[model samples]
Target: MAEALIKKHSRTKLDMTQGPIMKLVILFALPIIASNVLQQFYTIMDTLIIGNFCGATSIAAIGTSSQPVEVFMCVFMGIGGGVSILVSMHTGSKDDESLRKTVKTSVSFTYITAIPLAVLGIILTPVILRFMNVPDDTWDLAVLYIRIVFVGLLGNMGYNMNAGVLRGLGDSSSTLLFLIISSVTNIVLDLLFVAGFGMDVAGAAIATIIAMYLSWFSSVIYIIRKYPHIEFSFLPKGIDRESLKNILKLGLPLGFNNSLYTVGHILLQTLINLQGSAFMAGASVAGKIMGVSSVAISSFSQAMSTFAGQNFGARDYGRLKKGGRIVPLYSALITMSLGIVMYIFAPQLVGFFTKDGMAIKYALLCVHIQIPFQWCFCVLNTILNLANGIGAVRYSTVVNLLMLWAVRIPSAYLIATFWDGHYVTGGVSISFVFGMLAALLFYRSSHWARICRA
Candidate 1:
């Protein structure tokens, strides 16, 4: 029975190295897209539950806490990206031993980093919140939520690492299955804890942590039982110094790029914080709406990363290049269409989060100002992932730094400071467009092409 299950699971991995480009991209991307949409649905449900039961302040607290958590979580995510690239390459080359070694090292690395990072996150949550200038009214709840969420970093990191491994193996369906399970669990728990028990922000955080662990454990079990040939284990004996070195070399830049991007957003958040609680609430809700709206683009970008990674591993540069072009264009069109719908219904969507008229008004303004330019992110995510997929992860770092530091942050600060403070959200949204333009220019410079050719 176990052998049969293993064989069935193994057969499910899509071989990206051989397929019609569009068909392969869509087939690989659809399940991932569905998973992302479901994940977004549960997240929005959490916000809706909080908004309805716990009020806008609780909603704002979760929103405020989410930024710092994302900043910290990006480290693990970047490392996972590194793991996926290396694993995909090895898999493509039919180097089973190397693939197994990479998986072990990646899992070991995730544990080593996650433990300390969780501790540091717990210790630093308050300080980071202060730095973001979290308003007095929202402070205590934000702190509680962040601390609990930080404690679950191990689970979050574990799930992400496992998902990266599956993605590297060209098996997004398994990750999707796990995500659906997690999302459903989270939604039920959110309703029970926050709506039923009235634990408010703390309940939402707890529910999230429990869901994360559930997903992580599911992924771990699936990997162990269904991929016997991979020898999945976290034993210290699995650590390979050279593999670690390679992971860091490819991953550190990607990780830093993500952290740096988050840093830019934190800076923007600080500016938003200065605008007061109503704006904070509005911006918070707007951010979530935008996230939900952009799910398709985000999913496609991730799919492109894995698709390109496998092709790169197989040295199919032609297919990689073709995907690099096609996927971004497709992503942009879909994002633009979604942006239009979101813009038209911005008020209704924002209203779902709060009854506060002021909060709804400001949130509506944020959506109106930002949604039109949302397509730019599709370009940015697609190109960056393509670069990461081809082992030119460092180029992604450079591109992100240039965008966030050189373009986004400075523009946001100047606009918020010199212009009207009310324009801060718009400023940040416009900055994204500018940053994506810069990234597009970098992509067009053919620098990545040169690297791939060499």
Candidate 2:
């Protein structure tokens, strides 16, 4: 019965070792992508509300301040990633007891870590905003928005941790259900608070925080009630320090590197801000459009990781190779299609976020620059996901760090200084192109597969 349950619940939910690899992958990724895209709808609404009702500066300020908070959130994601790697491995190895402990400890660490980060965010909001060189006009609204999001850090971390564990168990569909419900709730609240009540950015922040907790709560309950195999009480008596250490050891560098990558983007954001409100507004709208496109890519990448991790854990090298080949190909094809759509409809997409004609025009320019690289991102992300799932999180981190310093940052700096073009657009677009190329090359290297063997 335990074995049956194991077979039933493993990530991708179905055993990928059987049947056509593409069919399994698409079936697994579709719902996860839908969940991810639905979750982004609230962000879309937030931008719409802030830009239309509260105006351009509000959108600019909030978007600017968002960078650092995102860094903190990415760290939580890293912790969750570590937990996921361990759970995936244990599930693959059929170690039920160890899986439970990993889940419990992961949740504990997430809660503990997130609280301090939240408190720090509250205290440091103004200082950090200043560091980003936020203009006097937008600082107050920016600070308010960032502070509220900070207050909800625990919820963000909790939800991500629980959902990560679930996905590790091969239950992507369940996580999707929670996200869909929460996303709907978020959209409703966003309309009520931001558009209906005119609560502005504060209202948008409240809607987001509330939705995160709801999703987290629902997932926790489901995990406890439906997935007793990974419940807290099922934790083994003999804690495996080595096992836990291995997870964290591989994951921490990735976490830190991801955090640093966010900082680099923040640096770029600072440059964006210095260009004034029009540039910021344009960038914000462009970012939202990009966010919409990127969601599908991210969903597929995440599913790929879970699928690859399970096969890796089982020592099913044949299935792993099938996954390694199929995922990038599928993701690239999908992204190229989306990229074409984005290129054609760039104006319409950016228009949804704001009415400012100049904002729309500049945003279109950024979108054009970005569309060509969307497929490249698909390839890079596919590689990263595969690396992560196969226990090469450290290598993934190293590649990311290298991409940032060697490819992205230098390209951005040179473009900004030499071209007399707007730093914000040049910085973002140039780095994106270089980073994608470099990432694809690194992904093709043998080191990642070697780590999987180790």
Candidate 3:
């Protein structure tokens, strides 16, 4: 009976080991794409409400908090990525026992790691804000917002882990469904707390945390009721040494890479903060816009990761090779199209966040400079994720470290310090281009391919 249930659920999963490659990739990616867009939309709405109701300082507060939050959450996201890949591989090979073990171990690991991380994040909120050099006008608000949000990190991590498991099982739609519910709830709460109640940044943070908990709750229920074959347990007996080792071996490099990447952003954010409130606010809005514009590429990269993980696990090199070539082309076309739209409307989009002319101008400039290079990002992300999916995580980590530390961060600092006044932000944009190109060159050299094949 359990085997029958497993087989029934299998019908919903995309068998990446065989299929019409383009169609399968698109079908797999579209829901993920919608989920990404909706997630970004609610996030944008959060900023929008804060900017409109709470003012520019509030906008800066939320924006500045993002880097530190990402830095702290990097390990959790890395583990989620690792879990997704492992589960996908097991699903591909139909290894039920290993799949159940991986799920249980991932759940245990997430809880163990998230609790301390949350406490640390709350305790260090002020220090992180100071390190980022948050403007005095915005520092208090940033601290308040970050502290409240940090309290909910466990819920956020829980949802991410469960969603990853679903995605690994080729059940992307379920994740999307839960995200839609969460996004709607977030927007409603944002309006009520920030606009109706006049709560400011704290309200926004509370809304976000509440929404995160809702998603986490829904995911836990779904997994319990639907995925009976996959054990969902947090008890000591559920822990397995081999499973833990496998997850860490695959996850830690990606975690470190994410931490390295966030460190670079923190450095860049500090530099941007030095440019004053207008520039800081502008950069924050620009970051949100860029996230929206790049959702397609990001979604497709995630899809590619799952696809590659499954095919590699099954040792189906031919399909993996075909996907390698076709996926990038599709991603480039979609990203290019979206990038052009965003560039054309850059001013209007930035205006949605702030009416301050200087803020809008800086934000528009950022969009103009970055959107043209969207294809480079698409290529870079897709290739790296593919490397991750194939368990060649170490190479991806090295590539990310070199690109972020060696290229992006230093270039941003040099431009800010030595370059002419008007060119600093543009120079930062150019660094992204260089970093992507470096990654693309390495990918083209087939280094990741060799690693995966071996």
Candidate 4:
């Protein structure tokens, strides 16, 4: 009776299925947006520090180094998406036992996957950098940063899995607190290690690892304290086959797609590399600026997934369909508004990173090409996320794969080969429009419904 009382009193429920749809989405998304903003701050700080202390080559190093880890991490993170969707569905259906099992399985999966990937990342860092044809000036910095990050891969991967579970439980608020702690920890450490200790790119990487571990540790404590009934292991006990099956069924296609997609990015990074370090540094700075708008775009998609997950699980097709109409409109408008502001302030923002004239030129050019079409990508993202929530992941996977491989990459190559090698970023904008159209078609066909019934 005491335990039951504790469970009832402690659980903070934001029932996504029952509330006013728009209000609930905005409320959930706000915390996620805040969290993303805080997350972006630390990322920007890393670049700002590198650009200031170590110079443009280091800035390019950071950019090129990240892709190798992202290639592996994206697969695991995609699986975490499966965890969130399942947890949300279970919450909607009020299946306590299965929810507990899914959490345990995710914990186990994280360890099993993270260790192997970390080892592989450490091994491949040098090889991958060479493949990207990293400039001689930036090569050593890129290798150092990539290896340091892989060494602490478990912490970052664990935190992402924890965040997925929290979002699934309709508890975005706790994640904001976690990000708050990590962001502050990261920025302070970045300053102390880089500025005070003169550790350079190595210092930036070290600061990031420590922050990631702390973030993951804090989340574990919070989950244990707040939900005493749901137990977890710091050292994963083992994977549960039944639970793993469910998660993989929803998650594997996503993992495969993300892995392939990031591989495409690695190839794209090769393209960025061929342009030389100055252009690469410029694109990196532009990415940081564009990352601001992506916060809202991603937050909305995540929030809608959680929202749609609950409604779909509860079999509230009406509410889910209703959101399919209203939420995308809100997402597109808000994301586009942010794009306009970022576009207006592009010069000032670019100035914050570096004063190198050529760097500034390439950065601003990429920004100009991408920012105006940002809304199109947001629309596609929101719709795909909605499909994901309802177990229609395979279709979303197909859409993403085609958008990257057939449309985006080909367009970039054709532009470079024929017209202007410098304007490949235009391909990104073209793909955004194409993806938006494809996503709309996916929704209109009600493809997700067949998947749901199956």
| lDDT measured at residue 136 in model 2 versus the true structure, 0 to 100 | 85
lDDT to native, each model: 0.83, 0.76, 0.84, 0.88
| Better candidate number, 2 or 4, judged by lDDT | 4
Please identify model 3 stretches exceeding 4 Å from their true place. Answer: 234-237, 420-423, 441-454
lDDT of 3 by residue, 1-454 (tens): 9899887767777888887988888898999999989999998998889888888878888888888899889977988899999999998898989999999898888788888999999998898889998989988889999999999898899999998998888888788889988999999999999999999999999999998999998998888777888877534245788988888888888899899888888887888888878888888899889988898887888889999899988988878877887898899889899888888888778888998888888888777777888787788788788888988888778877877777777777787778843345554566557656665664555655564465
Q: Cα RMSDs of all predictions?
A: 2.2, 2.7, 1.8, 1.8
Number of clashes found in candidate 2: 3
TM-score of each: 0.95, 0.92, 0.96, 0.97
* Tens-digit lDDT track of model 4 for 167-210: 99888989899888988888899889988898988999998899
> Which of the numbered candidates is closest to the native, going by highest lDDT?
4
Off by over 4 Å in 4: 2-11, 446-454
lDDT (Cα, tens digit) per residue for candidate 1, span 64-132: 887889878887788888998888888778778888788889878878889898999999998999999
Order of quality (TM-score): 4, 3, 1, 2
Clashes of 4: 0
Give the CA lDDT, 0 to 100, for residue 39 in model 4: 82
